[model samples]
Target: MFSMFRPPTLNIFSRSSRQKDSPKTDIIPHLTPNRFPKLIIASASKTKTEFSQQQKQSHLSSVKKATANNVENNKGPKADIPTSRSISTFPKKQLSSSPPIPRSTDVQPFKGLAKSPSTGTFNSVARIDNSSNTNPSVRVNFHLKYQTSYGQSIRIVGSHPDLGGWNLRHALDMHWTNNDVWTATIHLPSSNVVEYKYVLVSYDSKGALSWQSGSNAVLAVGEEDTALDVHDSWGNGPGASVSSEGGVATTREFKLQAWAQDMRSYKEVARSAAWEASRKKDELAAARAQIARLKMELGLGSKERTALEERVAALERANLLLRAELAQGKLVLKRTLEEAIKLLSQDALSVEEGE
Candidate 1:
């Protein structure tokens, strides 16, 4: 018991029960506590990097604010320049720089003209003498009237040569207009009382004869004078006369005289009738001779009236046949006409219906 009570420090062999019950430990190899130090350093480095990034962001924001302030300051003067409000404030110069013009200097005058005088004349006169009744002659006169606004003088211009027998006088340039009167004596040849006309012309203007185309009034001739015995159809002398049954004295006249026209017509009719009668007689004689010659040729006697009667009968029969054929043809024609009329009427009715 005393040993038990003695602490068990006796040997290394036997120990207290609590001590036995405690665990037995072996020493671990080299504990690395510096590994925790390394971890701390890594965490510190990450925190430093985050802080530096935040600082850099603050610096950039401050610099941007400064640059924006500077830009606002620079834009002030340019803003005072014309935006659209200052356009009317400038000066203007856009029109032409010349003076006014003057009027035109072109003008003209008008003039008039005058007419020249005409130098011509005409006549209308005829006469007869008792001593010259068997051989007659006529006289004519001319009265000229002319004037010019220019006071131009004119003369009478004739175109005849054989004037005073021996003299070969042609145109006479006499100032006849101022004299206003002139005469022309025409001695005609012996004729059966003929008619004539006078010709007038302007001496100055060439190709200006008075009688223009189709102008009947400037010069005209009348019927021949029937009193003179110019044409003696009865072979009578020129101065002889013819006594009518009415006891009227008629001078020797042309065969176709106006007073004897009716008598001449009656004579012509009588002669025509007599010729017709002679012609009819000759035609009858020819027919009789032809009948005799035909009878001889046919070996028939002069009494051939019976054969003629038979020919008449045959001609009558032929006439009846021709009449029957003509009636048939007429009937056919009438039928055709009626058919044509009917077709035309039908066509007209169709057209009316369509319209």
Candidate 2:
């Protein structure tokens, strides 16, 4: 309770000086206990706005004083952060200009590498770019799943020359779509399945080509569906099994099972397009029927509206006639009452004269 009444003590010297000086004693002047009530009364007498202004002024003054004290104390040289040569020893890392790579664990690896060509083949007129492909059965797309480091690229090499014919120098480089997943789409006219391996190409002057670990991925091109999107993971060699395809796939079933996923993807694409067209057709028919129904209702509504207006006018006219009849009856009753009252008064006067 006594502390609350006491004013706060403020230090005049720098923080460093405070450490060297006496621990408990301050250099501030002490206020007498008798002066505390006077200070409180003076503060209470001041308006709220004046009191706040004083508080802000005191705070700013203290800050300025502390800063001046610090400046005076720091006039000496600062401890050497690093000598000129030592500064270069800790090189600053440059900010990467490329986008941030996605977290590895965020996406599951593309389960199976569909052994499609590093490129695709275009049979017929090559209508993959058309609004709709000319042949859905001949389309196949490849998705390469891998995370690449800065200044490093991904490419594929296979038995075909287009894929560098297993030569690292002739490998077709895969393009990164900023999705951390590099993809290579082939539109070649070949319809044969091919085995391809992912290659890590360094952009340095040496131009090193590192082949992916494990076995090559095999893909059956243009098989079940004309269009397919398959994913491949780095180092996830081929998961080929035998018993799945009546053991015929014992060695091939693994590939076939993985390829089956591609087949369903294309079928789903075709079905969704067909279903969308049918749904739009049905909606058009329903819209036309609705317009016809609205037109009929509008025509009937015009006739009904005319009949309602005529009925309202007739009732209004009948109400006016009834009001006029009531007024005339009231006038007649008023005249009759006045004449009967005069006759009653004359009869009373004649009886009083006879008496």
Best candidate, TM-score-wise? Answer: 2
What does candidate 2 score on TM?
A: 0.29
lDDT of 1 by residue, 244-312 (tens): 223344543322244234334444555555555456546555655765677778767545856755655
Model 2 error, position 170 (Å): 2.0
Query: Could you tally the backbone clashes for each prediction?
Result: 0, 22
Please provide TM-scores, in order, for all candidate models, with all chains considered together: 0.17, 0.29
- For residues 79-177, what per-residue lDDT tens digits would candidate 2 score against the true structure? 223332443452223223344587988789577854543332212122233233343334434456677778887777776545667877656667677
In terms of TM-score, how similar is model 1 to the real structure? 0.17
Off-target runs (Cα >4 Å) in candidate 2 are 1-137, 188-191, 204-206, 222-224, 237-355
User: Total clashes, candidate 1?
Assistant: 0
CA lDDT, every model vs. true structure? 0.35, 0.51
